[model samples]
Target: MATRKAIVVGSGAAGLTAGWRLAQAGWQVELLGPEAQVGGLLAPQPVAGWPCDLGAHRLHAPALQVPAVAELAQRIPLEKRRRRGLVLVGGRSFNYPLRLTDLAQGLGLRGGGELLGSLVHARLSGRHWERQRAPEPQSDIGFGEFVRSRSGEAAYRAFYRPYADKVWGLDPAELSQSCAKQRVSSSAPWQLLWRPQRGEFLHPRGGFGAWMDGLAQLATQSGARVTLCQLSLQHGDLANLDADAVVHTGHLSAALTPDQQLAAQLDHRGLFLLWLVVADGQPGPVDTWYTPEAQFWFGRVSEVGNFLGHPHGRGRVLCVEIPQGRHAADRDFTGDLGELRRQLAQAKILSREAEVSEVVQRFLPAVYPLFRRGWLPRWRLALRHACASGRLWPAGRQGLWLHCNLDHAMASAEDAVRHVASGGASTQWPELAERWSEVRVRD
Candidate 1:
């Protein structure tokens, strides 16, 4: 039998995983990516003498259970770290994965009473339960409706609404219920307070990029070839590549026919990262600070040193993530560091006296998928069109337009390889693609 050939596009966690798995399965693999190094967003860059990830990233405990991820752990040294973060709202700091006592403290006696009252009202009314038992015909509720139904108006207004708006740059009502179902782990107030804490996560010794590099090394050792180049392939171009199977982990538009691309109208939310060195800054116990307030320019700020347990003598390196919408102009990229500092100080995450020694700006073109209302059918159709060739299989966050964890990406890659091994049928891929859509995004 002739050796099977596979071409994996995009070098993020998913593409690299696919390349490695295909090579391991005795298939000839060629992994193509724009950057010389693998790990798209997972890749780390040198900032202030420390390797800082593009954004705040970590391997959650659940992700470690994936076979591919587990195997990578054996190759790379991973450190177990507890998740510690704060959500700044209404000039108060509340523990993330919020605790009841902390919520009460943050909301105050009367506000806390109101919140509980609202939850009781929601339960007593039974509207949410009724909806769950017999959902509407469309069954595609809005994000605001989903949260309000389960947690009541108070929780939605106080917590979910602002954060959703800040992250996706869409009105909660315009966003799909799928966004809430996937992004939000728990919506019930009691569940939010009483859920067993699973704060432990894994981090590679060198960083997330190192893990990708490790996977790439394993793939290369297994005879897979890697190329550093960007490719734009149309529907007719699939025949040109001398590979039996092509795994696309890039934007959906990249693989779609021009006609399909024009009709899809699918888009992604970009992220602006402002890396700063705070001189003489004392590292806080909190690894990340999430700001939902619209007044603040950034959505989340993370201390890079805390991730690796590296104590810096001069200062701490902070990565501030600012969401950029599609309509945002180029000038919007120029973030105001002074205003950011003022907001941080106001939020009590930073000292007013702290001085920023250096600042660097990095922008990621696509970080989160804009899961607008009525996006499911459109995205599904787009994906279906992209994979109609049977040889092309869409995988990963960008390819599937899924807002998911790194582990999900690896698992998706595994699925693609399995499909290819099972005769690479186009008919079988839609079901697998549907399953990929159900993957939830982990914080």
Candidate 2:
């Protein structure tokens, strides 16, 4: 009857959740993170008196029912709000979770007709059924093919193609079908034809970081140790830690051997979060704006005030996500401010006369996993190598390379803890890992 010791790596939501759960289960837990604070992307920092996240992050309504997520909700007050956003396409503003009427009106006669015709043609030609009956392995089918099969060429080119290119900095043809399957919610053209309705989402009273801090506090209260220190498997750094189980919630590369790392060829897309304080700015009711066009350097822009339900005031902060492709040389992003402002004005997100009071730039490496074609096999191989010792458990978005939401990370943490509780059975984890692989990324 000895107390079990668990080491949880990468103090993000998954690591913190695993630490909390293990501690509550009467196990000794040590949660470690490279950053001083927890929450990873969910961490919020103050920008011009307004709390802004690294990016626009929110807990979808579906995650509320999760036991761990529900526990966090109890500790921190979560406000349920209807999702509001716009997608700017071809110089037209379309309500996000886009509506058919809006598209028809925005595209006008010729464009709308082509779009409608394409959809009809796709259906009549049974392209959707053909896609279902595609003989090629899922890995062989590219993102471009998957989208075109379901939504037709018009929709693919109009939105999916350009947006995927802008966000991931990869040709849609180079991206895996799994990427489309996980990230694109509406696979069928008919799905977009439905009447547009706002969806509900959850957010903490202060910011998402509050929830992470709360989880860490709860974990500590339950007798878990939290540390702000870096750990590396490549250098054999984790070899000395005396733990019955190690839950790794960082990038898979971090846990791999140097040779395995080279073989895996794993890569990530970095982000430049340009936080701007606009004086006398009116963001309207929109929470986020998606800009797929190449003219806009930033892919997505979010109004922090809208998330917290704060009214238009003297100033508001906007977080703009600019994807810095896989191997871009690091340089000063401030130089791009003028172009950003001009584009923001052009998009009508900001008034031309509005003065940008202050601008802060934060560069986050590895914001997203680059899901290149045939990446699954490599990812699985890396995961297997990382967990070969049977002591390490990879969990969370980064750990699993899953483009999932915060709730999914917490749920994965729960599953990891369950596996550890079962005496780290070798047979149990592969099934769990397979299940994790199938988790669809929610936008």
lDDT of each: 0.78, 0.79
True-structure Cα RMSD, model 1: 2.4
Q: Give model 2's TM-score versus the native structure.
A: 0.94
TM-score of each: 0.93, 0.94
Model 2 scores what on Cα lDDT? 0.79
- Residue 127 alpha-carbon offset, candidate 1, angstroms: 5.7
Off by over 4 Å in 2: 127-139, 230-235, 311-314, 326-329, 426-428
Task: Give a tens-digit lDDT track for model 2, residues 99-211.
Answer: 86678778999888888877777677655523442223454678898778767788778878877887787888888777776677443555667744658677887788877
lDDT (Cα, tens digit) per residue for candidate 1, span 1-443 = 99988988889999888898899899989988878678888887878777788888887777878899999899997898778888887778877766765776678888888788777787777655224422222677888987788778887787778778877878888888777777773434656667766676678877787788898887888888999786545556654677889988887788777788777877777888878888778777888998877778778898888786665345798888887743362534435666777877887777778887888887787787877777777877887888777788888888888888999988998988888888867546866777878766677
Off by over 4 Å in 1: 127-137, 232-239, 312-314, 325-329, 332-335
> What range of 10 consecutive residues in model 2 has the weakest lDDT sum?
129-138
